[model samples]
Target: MKRKLLGVLLALALVTGLAPTVQAKTVPAGQTVGTVLFYVTDKAGERVLVSQVPVSEMVSDLKAGKVDNTLHNYSILDRYVTTVHQEAKGFTIPEFVTYAKEKSAQAALRAMELTFAGQDAIRLWEIDQTGFDDLDTYTCDELYGVARYNYPLLYKYWDYRTQEYADPDGKLTRDQAVSEILKSAEPEVPLLSVLAFSQRYMITDGKYGTGDYNMESLWYTSGLMDSERTPRFMKPMTKEDLTGKASTAADSRYWVATLLLNMKDAPEVTALGAVGVPSAVMTEDGANYYVRFSCPTQGAAIYYNHNLISPSYTPTSRYTGDAVVIPKTNFPGGTVTMTCRAVKDGWTDAGVQTLTLTSSGAEKGWISPYKDVTAGVWSYEAVGYVTQNKIMGGTAKTDFSPNAPMTRAALALALYHMAGSPKVSSGTGFADVPSGASYASAVAWASQNGVVNGTASGGFSPEAGITREQLAAMFYRYAKNVAKTDLTVSRDLSVYTDYADAGSWAKEGLSWAVGAGLVNGTSATELSPKGPATRAQTAAMLQRLGLFVG
Candidate 1:
């Protein structure tokens, strides 16, 4: 029954053009019909045999699981036979098996050699039809066999002569071919190409499915199947690709007008002198044009919007160009400093610069409104010097309150500022001085430097009105600690009738003050030691002390 089934299956396969061909002749013992020789192209375009088994051996191998359905199935055989007939015309299939089993085995081995040589043994291979170009009667398998046999010899000679066996006609020995194949089985794909292919083709949804969104097929049809379609592999974009240059004079004019508008709107830039229309210089290298704007004065800060490019109210002395570079960032608007100098000798110009910010509002320096303190006033110079030095600030944002009584704490803070406001760890050595108080650090620093002493009650009395005598005593100590100098009372104080009434502790301070020419009496007979010192008086004393301290 198994023999009958085998016979029936073979008959069916033959009818379907799936059986291996056999030559019509006497069958040798132990050999069977069913061995076919044909050629097919491999992936690398090299010709290789479809199968290497004799028909009898193939049947036995198939039954024994030695040759699986994938390689030996009737369907595969039928397609293989049809492809060979179409590709290689006039090829015939024989009806009877012939040849000894040993000869069939040798043929199978030879076919295996052809297969290995064409596909795997040589690093490169191709058909040689140089002498057979006019031949049309030859079977495709015959032609393939001829090429296969000559490929290795030709490759070996070419490789030996050129040392480039990667080409089809290159010569190479069997060992050399095998070594080349072993070194690299396939060509390497570029990293960018692989990345592009993965990004475009390897879809997560419905992979390999045909659809409008199938990028692989779409790209293949569009002639962009490779990674050359990717941006990194393509030509790079120039600056013009991002933002175009102004082509016409009108366009340039419009840009210049817009830039001027932006500069005018910038809060930090105060245009000084005649700010003529801005201009730009275009370089040969196609760099961004360098814009220039002219200002009246040389020493002034320039700003692009709120960002300060130049800090001071002056420009560099070496800048002799008619225009300055319009300072700019990645923000809108521009700024230039506008400064005014006072005509009077004692009056301060404040050196204020107006800022016109892009996003935020404008910022200006504090302008005091104490109208009584004018340029020609007696205390004007003193107040101007102290205020300009930032040694003191007004009581209010605009009010100086020059006539207000100066307190001990206020005097300590003013002196501290004059001393550059050194860092203090803790409060003054007085029970009444709280840590959070504004003058706490100042009082602490003053006490630490022996510039001030607490009252008998072990309190700083920060809020108490500072008398002229007490002020003089503190200044004397400041001079001792900071200036490293002791005062010698060289001026005569006997002219003041009230001078003897001054406390002993303050007498020496008053004598020093008189000798230093820092103090004057209301009259020749009075030294107002107990009188409260006014803000104006304190400013005058600070102005004088500044000269002596340094």
Candidate 2:
């Protein structure tokens, strides 16, 4: 019986390539020690090998129950041994080896854990087992590792943010969610360091839906009463009803609409300066035009016109930049013709276009067309409505000089006109201006509007030519509500990298203008702030400040 058992064990070992050694015993008839191999797997699933002794030696150990004792230390062999005993004839050697390697509690536990993790585990396996160096090649699990181990919490957050029956308040508090996600990670992993991995795995803000409307609504609600205090990216605000904050109904919506425009699709085309009626775009037949009136000065009316040929407001889109297209049914031939004439209160023009059709004409999508010519040849159709409505021309000229260098006093006059040419009290005792100066009322109004202050002690330098850099500063202050009337105090202009040598006269304003992207230097690092202002640069800066644009 001993010989028979030894012979059976030897045969099994020889066929399975398991244990090679056995005490001198009957071996399988055609099998040799060289044919048998015994391998095991570590807890990590790494292959390891036991002794590869002969089948006769293996049987001797088995008879003494030494193989069983060996398997005790290497538990992976225990089950395989039992299987071998039950079906020794059909047991495959590779199967025996695989069973032996999967011998530890750690290995079994890991396998069980992986099973629970499901797809996450598979993703982990593919990433970890692969030898690729590129991070993109890693599976989500390989990328996230233990960080993604908790399936239940992940599911919970997913459910909370989605599904009809989800918990309303259970949306993972930022802390709760981040904490749970971090806990599953390895000790060495940095918190939030795995963002790329999360992105890779489509975790968190992945395929799951966005946050609830209630949460999104918080952006609009933080300062619901105070339009000035509202944060960006908030929900839509209702009309001008005071939200306990000093705000007009128009204030919150404009910003909210801007935010919505940026987030939902493209950037929004927003009107700057002063917001006015025609809140929405008007359509004529198949064409569309968005028009709004804004005041750059106290009494001025500035109209903005945008066509619907292509509606976009993002930097990447066409409508967001400086380029503008004025829609026309036909160029020179159609109802529109170029003509030189006196138009708008303060300006006359050499080149202007007049439209035969009005907004009520059969040719749809038409508004009254006009042109600008005084300063040089430039299109004024966009500004026609606003300029025509208000007397844009100064006292002497019926023509508006589009390219003329503005003076401190000229700007003051323009601003006064913007403010509806309000009656001036005068006699404020400006040391520089005589009591009868032409711009005294305008200067006084400017002081009232906080657009400017005197250049010297109670003296308005109305005749000083405005430099590009200085105008940049003036517009900046006007927009920011800083200059009292024109007496913008001069500061050392060293703050700007481009205009380090700017003259004292325009230095402070130049610094602010360059900083605000209002001016690009003439050279690599020279602002030449004292240089005369050009029509185009002035227009561009004013446009940036929500002032007049052409």
Candidate 3:
């Protein structure tokens, strides 16, 4: 066929000639920040990755004259990271693959099919070779413009009619050289397939996209591969199921979201309650991996008691909610599969997705409202104790937001839940803790019982995050006033290097907490009294306070 850019590559070798120096291009819209690794062949015949020339700095590397994309000899891969569980029961492959297939599947494919292919990538490299100072000096569009304006010199300097260059060497013909260079551009196995397949199958589909090689236009993906890494997009579905051979694939940001479930919350006993909505339903901005994905991102509705793992379609379930509940009777062996579909309003729903919940560390099998509270995590058991006993609940439907700062409102809520959500007979004098607010009764009960007090200006900074010493003081009062526990516990705060940083009033509480094994310094020597306390830290302290189960 037409090795169109091949001649341009040959012509550019001797050109000190007429390519215009173009001004810089503005940054493209909706560009995402991510890593794309490039590998070059080493003297050992292995493709050794050039460390700094790869991820995190490639764009800067190009701009700094540290790397070259002047030719297509480099094999590059765009990476998207995900985690996996060692056990087959919690494997994450299905979850990630489901994301790619359901969320933004064919939409990106269609748009890219019309404009992107392997030769487009080749032309990008060829344009860079024009030697107007490489990508360091000009943008991809500027390079393309330079080529568009100057590269047709191929017609003037070379003879396509004679099947040879105007200055061809006797040692090589045009066809032989074109074939060799094209072969070199075909990198390793999978990469070769990507390029050749694009040429043989998809070259004529579309061209003239935005011309921004810095992540505009379209890019190629390996396509969805089944078990053997065979392209599932290739070959027609057989008399049975098949890939149904076809053309090029697009890399999309429209992949579906997934649930990062709390394994400890898996059911074991009589009845596991409806857990919580997923905290990690999707990736990046919570709705899209790509900024252009379907908007007003939505959650999914789970259909459980279906008893099937991978159903052909959405099932008619006995129940539907944000989370799944399986009784010990239905989940006899500690494993139950449920189906889910996205509740996306204007977009396509991810049809019958199968998810499984399994039994965790012990027989009590407490199902939590927080997906962040999982087995093996540092505060797992502590979070379990508080959540199981109703001392704490999620800040959101399914998220504990463990790393988030612990606010006074959350503290009040937890202490109230610990008090069995008692009805408040009187009001808290603090103006901020309104009578109608959710934590009103908790603050009221705690205030009446001397478990807490109003801050300066007669107001509670309910939304403000608390320092570590403040957490110690409030829980200490709860221990003394509400729980009416012994107040004799004490420790030498001087042992900690930062002990003097604690406020005088909080020293008693901090000492008591340290003595009672309810709180530990952030490090062995530093008691970060003024440092912000996170919800996770509070959970651990609460668990050790003898306020709930050990």
Best by lDDT: 3
Encode model 2's per-residue lDDT on 84-188: one tens digit a residue.
Answer: 110011111222223222321122211321111112211000101111123212222332343211112222232222211233256656456545533432221
Q: How many pairs of residues in model 1 come into backbone collision?
A: 19
Candidate 3: where is the Cα deviation over 4 Å? 1-362, 547-550
Error of 3 at 275 (Å): 39
RMSD in angstroms between candidate 2 and the native structure over all alpha carbons: 32.2
Between candidates 1 and 2, name the one with more favorable lDDT: 1
Every candidate's lDDT: 0.39, 0.31, 0.39
What's each prediction's TM-score? 0.33, 0.33, 0.35
lDDT, model 2:
0.31
